[model samples]
Target: MQAFAYVACAHKKTNLTNLLISFKDVSIRHFNTLVFEDLNFSLEKGQHWALVGNSGSGKSTFLDFIMGKASMARGEAYYPYFDQHIQEHHQDDPLFNRYKLITQVSARHEFRNLSNTSDFYYQQRFNSCDSEDADTVSTYLSSIKVVNPSGLWTIQKATEWLKLTYLLDKELIKLSNGETKRLMLAAALIKNPVLLLLDNPLNGLDVSARQDFNELIREISESGISIIMATPATEIPESITHVAVLESGKMIIQCKKYEFKPISFHTIGQIQTNQDELKQLLSATPSVVYDTIIGMEDVSIKYGDKQILDGVNWQVRQGQRWALTGHNGAGKSTLLSLINGDNPQAFANKIILFDQPKGSGESIWEIKKKIGYVSPEFFQYFPTGSTCLQVIESGFDDTLGLFRVSGKSRAETSLRWMTLLHISEFAGALIRNVPVSIQRICMLARAMVKNPSLLILDEPCLGLDVERQEQFKNLIDTICSMTDLSLIYVSHYQEEMPLSITHSLKLEQGRVV
Candidate 1:
């Protein structure tokens, strides 16, 4: 179990200079099903490994094992000796102090669930609140556990290195996804972790944010820190030195990055359709004329001391789709909130939803009836107790549970949509027990079950693997082609945009720039 390595490909060999981690004949089981059977994996002192896999391929479970959060039924795992070996024993050595796993879900949880914020922060967008009283970015950074937090100079240097100096005084909640990620990276660097384990770190970032993070990863690797990251094959970073492909909980193949090539799980062929076929598939009517569906004039939102949106003007008409683009903290979510009637600030803004003016005193229920919304946050709050069929049925009333009968016709329509989405087998299964990819499809089915005029999707493809993403993207394209649904799709990943999106509105620093 000591430091050792093995030969790989000709050019992508594992250098045995120093071993960081090793596993022999590892077997992991969940509910009597083997996740990893007699699997052997190794990590050396200075190499970047990409754990590539599709959804439900157990990539996250493998990562949990590395993080010491997953227990193996049988296996031999090894790590380097730490200073704690003297105080107690090698078994008591802390493995995570030198290892960091940057996951997409946990980052969001930290933003929403972990942040200790005041009610004013969530309820209001603008007010003469004390910025001085807000917890500054620097205060949040100091909370990260580090070996030498007293090293203020080191922390300051890391801050500048990550370009977070301007955000030092900004409230943590005000920071965007990319900004928060940078802050987390700074904290990881301050701890001087020798091995950094990341899970889909690039999933929710825009092009600029992804580039910035890529450069940061290169810099961190250059500083002598080894990195092991997990991402789908389609989204794997070019800097990866080695690659491992997991299939059905097994390491089907492991090789050098240069020797690696993608293996597609399904043949994604071209979608073919004529005008009539497209209309029938999407339930679209070509005869419909254009009309305004959403309007915002000189709309502005301010909360405490921060301005989220400023004098923004936008319009969405019938049969027209729009893509919302921006960096993290660009007020994309806030803008959607205003349209969805979730934010009280919407009442103060000059906004119109489905021809109904915001200040017109429209009931929340009435506004919601004409619009369908889906997001990662919504998935977290979706009712888990309901069956998949029941969940889809609830979309008719915009309620979490099935109270009133949707009628036989409505029930048949929901079943048809589920079948079209290839999830009919799980119709009776609890929505909570379904895989995330399936859950997304179910939510999408529910969103479209009512066939509302407006659809708001916020990062709908965030956690999906490459295969599921492609399937979902195609499904969205089909939805757009066949239906007259006006889409306000908000996503950082431009590649995930639906084919139906024709126009874009970009936001920068609370302004439509």
Candidate 2:
């Protein structure tokens, strides 16, 4: 389709603005895994669209294609003639500026995923080439809210975004996964693309940051720049003019601005689950309080100079459920290092698991076998490229399938959990292929496969939304009922707490308050 003057584009076009970006019968694949096929979407100058789907649903891959970093193997991605055509007509027309199509994937991976191959003078993975003018770039950086640390920087807008995302303290060469994700989000917002194509814009932001992002999205969309974004589940702004639903990489439904959302699918909208009643029911059952699975008396842990956990006297009673709630830097996780003594490499102050002091004669591996842990950091240490099932199975030994010998029941055990989480379909899928939400379920399944008496979850809902959170709580409640598992749950949201936990262990400023 040729360009039409803008009348809200997408068949609602009454004005003569040209179609800025449109693709037909498009299909894309990442190496061997097929992301999506026969996918068709279009964007005009003023429309705001949401590409909503679950994680591993090729949302980011779609954005990659639009950004010119990914290939279109089986369809046409037609860009409307603007500056190139305008030059042919009037070489001096100011209205014919070249359209730059940028997407979130542009800054996703600095290690190798970046399609731009032009080498820089000074090479660093995280820090890019310095801008043409250092002082000038510094001003741009500050606009994105970066206070230049060195005071010699120039025109580096992206670096400021990285700072705003809390990457300022991290070295350019040593960016963590979370740091990288933050960098990507910051990059997309700063570029101000004519038609911004975002894939899971809320991927790495916190709850409050999400509210900030909502404001940012509204501001950008209000500027009439246009946006096409994908999300699993989030409260979107009222500015979203169109919505599309996809299943198994196929477009199941598509609707116009006003005609959206009255239609529903069976699996789409369902109360599905809420385990608060079961939590209360389980709370009534008498807890064994099995002789202090772990204990700490006036224990204070000092790392170099900073004392993370100070004057900490606590107990992990056998078969008693408890949760640790605090802010991000608060000692919830550091306290876990105090509780989790299943491994020798991990250390803390006066940690005693199962009545055996971790530093004593007890075998660390055996202790690990009795204590199940699920955390985002744990998943980070897990086999990076393993399939979801492999990661889940490895939890039995806390190794990458090395703790135990070759097994016959491993797949069966893993499958049992994969089915429970509604993620059996992703058993063979690579961990990196799925979203963090799915990976978290897989991580929880890995912990569940071992069936430990003491289960420690460190922010188990790292990337889960309301739907997946309910699914997880249901499974956890069932486990609490069927086994003697005592939960040491950690979370930021009280709403996510399963009332099965009768004990309260709140932390404030790294001290039990």
lDDT of candidate 1 vs native?
A: 0.69
TM-score of 1: 0.79
Q: TM-score of every model?
A: 0.79, 0.69
Put down candidate 2 lDDT per residue, 1-513, tens digits, no spaces: 111111122344322265766678888876466777888766666778776555455656666666665677798876664343445654665643443434454323433222234322211321223312122222323444222232222224445534443435333322323344555555555555556676665543445555556666666677555777776434545677776655566654555645554223223342232355334333443444368787877777554344556787788777788977764445665577556552222344566678766677766577777777886545544555788888888887777444555377877767766765678899888887776678888888787676677888876875565557776776777767766778888775677777678687876657888
Q: How much is the lDDT of residue 377 in candidate 2?
A: 48
Task: List candidate 1 stretches off by more than 4 Å.
Answer: 1-17, 30-33, 81-108, 111-136, 148-154, 169-175, 262-290, 380-416, 425-436
TM-score of 2: 0.69
lDDT per residue for candidate 1 within 302-389, as digits (tens), equals 8767688999999999878899988877888778878877677788878878776887868877877778888765554455788898
lDDT, each prediction:
0.69, 0.59
Residue clash pairs of candidate 1: 125-302, 125-303, 126-302, 126-303, 282-482, 282-483, 284-482
